[model samples]
Target chain A: MPELPDPTHETYYSAAVNEALDEELARDPAVVLLGEDIGVYGGAFGVTRGLFQKYGPERLWETPISENSVVGMAVGAATLGLRPVVEIMFMDFIALTLDQILNSAGKLHYMYNGQVTVPMVLRTPGGAKGGYGPSHSQMLTNLLVGIPGIKVVAPATPAAAKALLKSAIRDPNPVVFIENKRLYPRRGPVSGPDFVQPLECAEIAAPGSDLTLIAYSAMVPLALEVKKGFAAEGGADIEVVDLVSLQPLDTDTVFESVRRTGRVLIVEEACRTGGVGAEVAARIAAECLDVLEAPVLRVAAADTPIPSSMDLEKIVLPGIPDIVRGVHELMAW
Target chain B: MEPKPIDLLLDCFRKMLLIRRFEETLSDLFERGALGGTSHFCIGQEACAVGVISAAADTDYIVSNHRGHGHLLARGLDPVRVFGELMGRTIGYCGGRGGSQHMCAMDHSFLGTNGITGGGIPVATGAAFALKYRKESRLVLAFFGDGAANQGTFHESLNIASLWKLPVLYVCENNRYGMSVPVSASTSCLPIAKRAAAYSMRGVTADGMDLLAVRRVAAECIAHVRSGAGPVLLELETYRFCGHSKNDPRVYRSREEEARWAERDCIVLLGKRLREEFGISPDRLESIRTEVDAEVEQAVAEAQAAPSGDDRCALGGVYA
Candidate 1:
């Protein structure tokens, strides 16, 4: 029998991001951190606590509340041969800087005929709740996933957060690494606390061939929990695939599982309509429709703003029950 | 501030004239359907753009605005590419992909002039920070309007630029109106440069219409920034010769005020000085004009003839 790795102490998603930033800064001179209040305040979420003390104001910069400007600054900094991990505080704030991210950060490589690459990683906390209703909370992955020239990543665990961010910072292209504000502090084992996972692969945590459960970010943890419960009680077979990177979605792994299982269930914390679930379903249908034995089932939050109440939040968000029911429904077909 | 006999002075004056005429040309063309998309002319406030670039070396960077033809020309960007960009042709700076406002020319260190207001301010600040980190002497100039002065990014960039002691020059072109809204109505301050005190930065006021004053102020700020004293702000009190854009009738301003600024026309003022004070012979001035006019026309012809890119570009840049 082999030994199982223990999950590390959970701190919350912001803490994981801050640890990764600290590790990366100590590890590489080129890696710099920029965001609003990441200085004396240690970030809005306390992820960047004491970074200003360690790295000084030169490496750890705190910019004004200008998403566009901060993003643009990140781009220019990256273009000039520095690696900048820019934090946008909240996902909704991206609306203010879409031009810099969408136009400048996302277009610099192609615009310069591949001569210039802006190696920047934009980190923002997303999801509903946490005292923020509509204005502060939003799942921006839906909008960011559709854009080209940028890699979008959402890590559900501390290990995944640290691993994926390291990879994103090293990659040649710009990356939009989203930290689900709700998933911070949750921890798991990593090959190295400073390890970097491949950004283009979906991690398959459990092995099964009956049906594939595609998920990312916070939804992946929920889907995995449901998969374990489904295997034990429902005796329903399900394969859990964590799409670590959403933009360059590792569709090959997903489709391969779909081909074997002959069914698919996608779980997303984002609203169902235009969510990453829709993207997975459309791609599977368009590319491998014949391989599917049943319709692609999706366990996603309702197409409404995330409610603040814990009870309502559970109902609105994709949870274990919703995912289990989705697996059960697919099994029946 | 007195005008200097520096060659840059005469050269910038002609460039401003060319920009005025070029924008006026675009306005005429836009009216007759010769050019497409929105047009924001730097008609009256050409000196700020012309003068600031005069302080720039080949390596320094600039982040401009939508109304950037004057800066583009002043920075020695070929008119062909500028006009080509407005017309959405491949020969443009960004291959016609970015038209009217978003023009990128790395050769001259003009990173971009974003369509969104206050978008480039942070970027310029970041570039300056990078220079300090890399130990490069290159100074970056971020040019924004009076309206952008109120933006969160404006505050963020200024704050960081001063806090980090980065080599950056913040040039604010206070042309009275941000779009149709007057500065007095949009901002709570009479002189926006007074706000520099908030960040512990040195602030100076320059007659935006006077190229030499703009150049002198910009040079001082650039030196201050390069010496590791951090960023400084220079407010060029200028006025827009045309409306907010080509379509704007500028019903916001009185004809009296418009004519008053017109009398202070930078190009007109510079040309008179070039001929009268510098004793640059009328023939030499005429020769310079003839030479620049021919070059601008050739550039226009070549840019117009340049092929166009498919505006249907589906992918973004800077990523794989």
Candidate 2:
């Protein structure tokens, strides 16, 4: 086993991803990396850096940017019993490869009547705030999660990113690993011997009863910040639920918390129209409507496209202010 | 071209004939309104699909485009299930989730074909990468038509395949038309094979009408990758015998042009070559044809008679 790094050490999500590759390669020879620039170039986001040299071109594959092909290849490989992780350059690019993801990889097992399994993970950079504009920025968590066969994991913190990625690779089921570029640098405590979530549970960032703030990926960090502010200003314990997974939602956890707090607020960086927030809100409303002390609320990016300017980008993407207001409004309601 | 053994040649002939009859059967059912939805016939493009698939191991995977029945049947997919799927039966490869355009079969190494052009290219890379990762020597043969070669995924997948030297063989069946539009209208390059130069891979064109030529070229491409030389692009100049699908009247192609290509029917060409050039007896050729016809009929009957899977299975394969 590679020596563990010190607890005080922290790094970017890119670094975490690199570390995951290193660890998994060391752990199992079957885990492979395939995508554009994943080998010699180290991937578009540098997630597969240094891996090509260590694992060689055979293990660390540099593939053509055929998202559909990349995913389809992984599905084929997984059926033959290899654990493959594919990096789909961007979440928005998924639309180009929807058939591969939705039709092939997503439904292989059921389509084959349990004769096969696709043990693969599609690692993709998603959500807005990057200057890439309409072509690149996309919140695909909702799209992937809506599919039945796959689980969509959006890791908000660096620790969660590494742990969730490892779990996704090892899982027998196909998982769409949606990594938020915005939260790549955020740090938090993560225990290991390695980890895998139970697939349908929410991780409680902080416990509280005044209001429940439910969020995932980049929005989780902003929710935590809002929770801290609320604790200091109003002395209220605003529980924060990090929905590490958008699909196979941790509805039980969020509903239980909301039922206790009588107030709830959902946050997302995706556009308000048909964003992941709608699905989360609908779940809460359907399951715990009577138990809520107030109506569930949502704070998300506006319907317009994300601006190129960093300042405007930050303003449009949900932030602590919007989250605080949403929480406060729910608390008062 | 390397001389192929008698058994392999016979298998190739069977596969091509099977595809011809299978599509012919579907054409009849579709025109008769039995099989709804779109059906892109590979009637003329049989050799390219069979040639590529023949060189790959059963476990080695395949990724295909929408007009993929030829590729699917070439890879030895059960005709009945495929027909059942087109007819919206649970017996279909996709369990009715994917109709005519979205057929999938993992057991036969026939990964599902997609509706989008060039959509399965990336997934082919993923499958090959997975195979390499597991130390499985499995390769991926991805089949796309000339129309798909122009999609963004074609550039992305080819570039990646060349850069990484992934074990992939890209077979572009340049049927000279994308629906009603000719290749000249949709593509700027003189030959689709030339596009491989942009990605740093050797590209070559072959006679898609001659089963021997397609087999020879496909084997070479597959051998190049299996030998660790990396991916190669193959452009097979062919034409679909039928309309683009059940609905396409193919107004873009002149009857004269169609006749010119039809003069080189891949299945018929191979049978003649076998009897004339290889010294196979006429009785042997007729026997093979009878066998192919009976096989297609049996598969169609079995698939039609098989019980549609339980409706509760609607959400069955989602998990595994």
Candidate 3:
């Protein structure tokens, strides 16, 4: 690993993503951006702001409202030599591009027997935020985590967002960088442009011994908040682990944490059934059953579509209170 | 129109014959249970593949679809390697991973053949974008069926290619039917080439059964694309003599329609042209057929003898 960059200044989550794209576009000529309104409009969430003026139209391509073909185009470009980072605007709309992403992009490398590599990154903002409703807001990370060839990564903080996005761009395989819509405005310390986090590892955000909370993306911060509140009240010393890479998951880190804590809680923003939490809980049951003191619990959104109203949306989505209650229940058990 | 050289005509005829023979062999193998899984053969659409690919430069990229054996052969892939892949041998183009419909020969500038309709259209468009971004002169050629023309990818790719002026040739081999459904039933537009005008691009139709006519139209479209005129949609009006796959009983069409297409068999049409226009002897053509048949036989034997891919290595190549 290269020397880690010292913390320079604080940056917003979306701005950090923009900084990584800017640095990559400047560092490598093969890097290009493609998506609707990504060029002139600077992306739906402004994650690609000012890139159009900096790199011009050739490098920053503004595509029409064609999600399927746009991803297909990125896959094609990646195979040929260009490292295309495609923005699908919202993770919900990735349904339209599933054929290209799953069949074409995800299967091409294996199907071609490694003759081609899709060195591309699909960056999309997901999770219920600002009451975008069921269509615009979704934590569809589960849809991609089960895919074998594709890598799925979600960054919870501004620094990790920058480092992971940069690393995702440099990876040779297809990577789905899931960005939570709600985390965009949050600010955190970011290292210099040279910092790059590994793609297949988990970071221990807060260390404890009484219980462990495994979460990713927006849930990581929520898990940390629960831990902070628990420590302030002199409750159980809960540990928080941020799973940066969801697929090819760092099971070692998770297993190690589970063994030490004995009681574990898996948290996610997706719905309760068939979510990433289920997978984590299953893995823990399989490997750490002997060490576990109590049955593993999960804190996730209710099994329902996100409503447009913030009140209804909060009810459907998991929140800090839910995590707090789940932690208390696990400690009591 | 000035006549093409006799040697070039003869080469095209030989290639079409090879593809015809290859498809026939695959059908025979499937019947005998020698090969598993389904394979889509471009039996009657040989001229379209040969004519369009022959017009392209060796460095140009090609994105083919499910019915792409002729396209791969015309792109200069080794018959033995193609056979090896279809037979599940490790020596295949994709190390036996990608079967008939999914093989890719990157060294030959041939991208993988897609199983989905219009799947390769956007891919070729993207390849063209890459070529243009790097300021390369080479272009990309995408092949899809008539049914694929109605796919959203076709329309989306053409629009992007035209808007960006990407150098690519969109070849729509309109063989009348997309599997069981005929073009007239599935498509709302008459003459799929006309759809190109909506994207502000040039479009043309060619006699896909006639090698010379296809070659002529493809050459013109290739030139237009090579000159950075964006992309062109060349609709090759042709027909498939065989059923959609080997299993179809032709309940959808009459014998008369099948006979009408068989009479215009691209291989036979080219052979007749060679005899009349190029003054080629019938015996010489017979020798070429004999030579190609023997080559196909040899490839099949070699592919059969080659070892199957190891099951343990199946997990490999899933990521770079």
Candidate 4:
């Protein structure tokens, strides 16, 4: 296993996004932002607080209620040499702007024979919390993942979120930077102002060899909780892998972990059908068929709309117990 | 900023004629099964593309739509490369990846055209924002069809452009139909220009078939927007002489309506105006036609002879 890198400071998940954006804005003149209520309202999740006052309206744009155009505007700005970060208020609303994101921003760089690059970041908060109901609380990362010419990043911790988002802003392609809504208040150590994560690598949050736990975004912390429980029980050494880059799968880390453990349990907050977990499981099955001691398993949200009630939500969403059960089942196999 | 000279008008005429001939040649090729897919042609709407683009500075930006060959040609994209792209050749502008609707000439400030209706409007507005933010002495012109005016993006884009005073000229080429739906049927308002008042911006309508009218109006609008007065909406009333695509059999409209629009053809209108107003001789116009025909023929020949785009590299360039 690769040695873990050291971090520098501690901050909340939302603060990580805010600090990264502030630092990027200070470092480059071309970086700008646009979204609904992001200026005075400081974003729907309060992730862009104080940026409006610091940079003013020129760089920080408070747009009208037009999701498609907001993303479209970002694509246009990116093509014309401006790096724009667009925030959709909710992940569900991203459906309105998929045409711009998929058809225009994602394809412009390639369709035009590399004549231009869409160096833009579409930042949105997904995952279920606060009883927001189906429309607002959807983990739709796979929608962006399936599209070519776009990078999809779903960081698991404050440090990972901050570093990966900065890298996403600096990347030469369009990036869908999805933040998990449930992780906004989760406090963790983040690297200092200069830290930037690689856009194509995954992080091994916990080192183990007996079994592997794979997850990303909000599910990573849940997987960690499962790892802690397994450790307390004096069971197998459960290694938890944080899949930070979702689209360009970090197969090196995944394959190595699966080969070492010979047992795998993938977890995701999104629906089970056609989720990232399914893809990761398929990759492991195809690449490490002989190495696997058991069939690859996935613990994802049930194939149903996210319920409004917390009781029903718990049943629908994958909880820490669900990950533990899956890990135990895989080990027994 | 001065009144454009006769040479500029002649240049516009040449480009408009080139686009007309280019589309005609494509029709002939498609008829013979040389080309694979259906293409949207701007047959009678040449003046809108020529007049609007001619008024724009070389540094200014222009976004086009599906029916965009005239716009691309008028923006000075090489006819040979344009033909190569339509023919899916390696020598094309986009290496044959973008057939017609998605090709872009970034060097010429011509943003790619969109197959999705009203998709490029906000992008143009964003480019306008960049231009103004960077303090560059340039603006963007986003061209969409009247059919696109119904899209929420069109209204939303205009609202933002006006609010922020972005340097964008939103030109709507109202050729009267969105596939089979006529303008009167699809549009809530007769002229798309009237809706601009809701955004608190100036809107104007002009005869899109008349080169002089389109040029005069577009020049004023371009200057106004370029000077940072904010965005302006210009709805050009025009018509398409050809069917929407290769599949149409002209069952949607009467022969009398088609004949009426053909009589007011922009290319014929400009040719007559050149002889009557500009004191150009019939022989000179005839010579210009002959020269443009030869140039287009040569471009078609070169494009047809060019190597087909490699399928091996088809998966490449999905990311930079």
Each prediction's TM-score versus the true structure? 0.89, 0.86, 0.98, 0.98
Q: What is the per-residue lDDT of model 3 for residues A1-333, given as tens digits with 9 covering 90 to 100?
A: 122369888989999999999999999999999998987789989999999998998799999999999999999999999999999899999999999988988999999998999999999998988679989988997788777799999989898999999999999999999998889999988998798889998888888999999899999988888888989999999989998899888999999999999999989998888867888899999999999999999888888888999989998888999888888888888
lDDT (Cα atoms) of all candidates against the true structure: 0.80, 0.78, 0.91, 0.90
Per-candidate DockQ vs. reference: 0.41, 0.41, 0.87, 0.88
Alpha carbon lDDT of residue B144, candidate 1?
89
Query: lDDT of candidate 3?
Result: 0.91
lDDT of 4 by residue, B40-157 (tens): 9998899999999998898789999999999999999999999999988999998988898888999898888888899989888888888988998899999999889999899889
Task: Kindly list the per-residue Cα lDDT of model 2 for residues B1-320, writing each as its tens digit.
Answer: 65568778888888888899888988887778765677888998888888878766777677788888888887787788888787667678776767666677877877667677876777686566555545567688888889888887788778877766778888889998888889999899968999999989989999888888888888888888888777889999998888987877777778999998899888889889888888889898789889989988898887777666576767555676
lDDT of 1 by residue, A1-333 (tens): 012244445455566667778888888898989888999899888888989998998788777666777787888888778999988888888988787788778876765445457889998888865556767767878888777788888877777777678888888889998888767756555434545678887778677878888888877777778877877885867788888879888889888888888899988878888868899999999988988999988888787776666676766777787777888788889
Model 4 chain B is weakest, by summed lDDT over 10 consecutive residues, at B308-317
TM-score of model 1's chain A, to 2 decimals? Answer: 0.92
Q: What is the DockQ of candidate 2?
A: 0.41
TM-score of 3: 0.98
lDDT value for model 2: 0.78
| Per-residue lDDT of model 2, residues A158-193, tens digit only | 676777777787889888888877766555544353
Which of the two, 1 or 4, has more TM-score?
4
- The top-ranked prediction according to DockQ is 4
